[model samples]
Target: MTELLKPELYAVVGTMSAPLHPSLKGGRCMACGFVFFPPQRYGCEVCGRSGDCLQSIALSGSGTLIASATVHMHSPGARPTKHGVKPLEAPFTIGTIKLDDGPTIRTIIVDANEPSLKPGQRVISKLVEVGSGACSILDLRFAPAL
Candidate 1:
């Protein structure tokens, strides 16, 4: 049987399922309508509200690429690693995506070469697997919208 890919960051990602769109999960402050990625649990940063006023919400997978950069050299050295989750390779593209809903998130640009992306371009979220062999981690990535 194939090993299941676990999320490296559970609070920031949703449960993975086939035929399901991959979206970055966020928290919305019910008190002030403030949306933030990587879901906050303590209190609202905008309105100083605490307790259960923060509700879990799913963000839109489609967004506009506001900023992007190509990494020529990378050293992911001395980073912590969880079981079954391996570090990704270097020289990848990373970009900031402004979701259609509200939040802006930084994500890996899948299959993108240097100088291939620009601001104001449309992109869509995708769930990808990082690492090799039997162990991998499920992660949210972005690609140009078709």
Candidate 2:
């Protein structure tokens, strides 16, 4: 069975063993109508409402690429990981994406040719394997939608 890399940050559509659609774990203010990503219990930034006013929500993973950049180097030794998590190799790409649901997030972009990517291109959520121990550990990534 596969496992999500960070259950607190995102959720899978179908099942953990075979995730179909990936989405971010977010929050909405019950006091106001503020929606946010990376779910936080702290007071709402919009309404100043406390944790009680926040409700757990799932954010749409689809978005538009605002910008992208590729990292071409890595520090000397292999980076340490918790629980055998595999550190992404250098030359990986990262992108700033604005979700259709109304939040901008910076995250990894896989299966993409960085140089060819253009701003405002549609993107979709993807789960890619990052490690394997007792089970496959999958992490979230964004890719340009064809």
Candidate 3:
């Protein structure tokens, strides 16, 4: 029998399921309605509410492409572990996407070439598998929305 693989990264992105489509998990201030990605752990930056006032909230992965650029160089050590992840190839396209809700985030653009991307293009979130063996990691990426 095949063993189930545990997620290398959890609580960051949703599973690849029907209703639980891939989305970023962020933090919301229960004291207020402010939301933040990389979920604030200390306290609400807006209202200064700490303790249990912070709650986990799922963020919409769909958004608009705001900007794009090709990275010609990067440090390997700065990259995620090379286990199941693909080797870093320069000139990859990463872009800023403005989530439909309110926040803007940067993500690697998949399923489209850098030259093809344009400002204001719609995109949807997708979870991709990287690395290999037991070190496999799941990463969030965006693609042109159909």
Candidate 4:
């Protein structure tokens, strides 16, 4: 079995065994009906209610891309590392997406058969392998739905 990079942020079910391919772990304010990502336990931003007022929910994986930018590096072998994370490779794209549910989030974009992204482009959540060893370490990513 593969390991999830962030089990608290999202969930992915096997294609043949489950219905939801991927879903974001989000939170909703039971009092005010406000929805937000990252499933925070703190007080809701829209209302002052906390504790029992916050409820965890599974959000749909579809969203619309608001904007995107690709980062490029100039020098080779000059990558910087923080903590234990290896420096990100150049030409990786980051996108600001507004989920269909209501909140906006920023995440890495991977080209999965879709063309260049533009504002208002449709995107969907997908799992990507990030580890290099025998055991697979899977992380979530946003990809164009075309």
Among these predictions, the greatest TM-score belongs to 2
Higher-scoring candidate on TM-score, 1 or 4:
4
On TM-score, the stronger of 2 and 3 is 2
Candidate of highest lDDT: 2
Superposed model 3: Cα runs more than 4 Å off: 1-20, 76-79, 134-136
- Cα lDDT, model 1, residue 139: 61
How well does candidate 2 match the true structure, expressed as C-alpha RMSD?
3.4
When summed lDDT is taken over every stretch of 10 residues in candidate 3, the lowest stretch is: 1-10
lDDT of 3 at 33: 74
Give TM-scores for every candidate, taking all chains together and pairing residue i with residue i. Answer: 0.80, 0.88, 0.77, 0.83
Considering lDDT, which of the candidate structures 3 and 4 is the better prediction for this target? 4
lDDT tens digits, residue span 32-74, model 1: 9998887768888899897789998777677899999887777
Q: In model 1, where do residues sit more than 4 Å from their true spots?
A: 1-20, 76-80, 84-86
Write down the worst ten-residue block by lDDT for model 4: 78-87
Greater-TM-score candidate between 1 and 2: 2
Q: Which ten residues in a row have the lowest lDDT in candidate 1?
A: 10-19
Q: lDDT tens digits, residues 18-129, model 4?
A: 2345788899999999999988887999987899999988877788999888777636765432222234677788889998887898988997422478888888888887
- Writing each residue's lDDT as its tens digit, candidate 3 over 9-105 gives 1234453431344666677888887787766579888899987899876677788899999888976666644445666577678999887656688
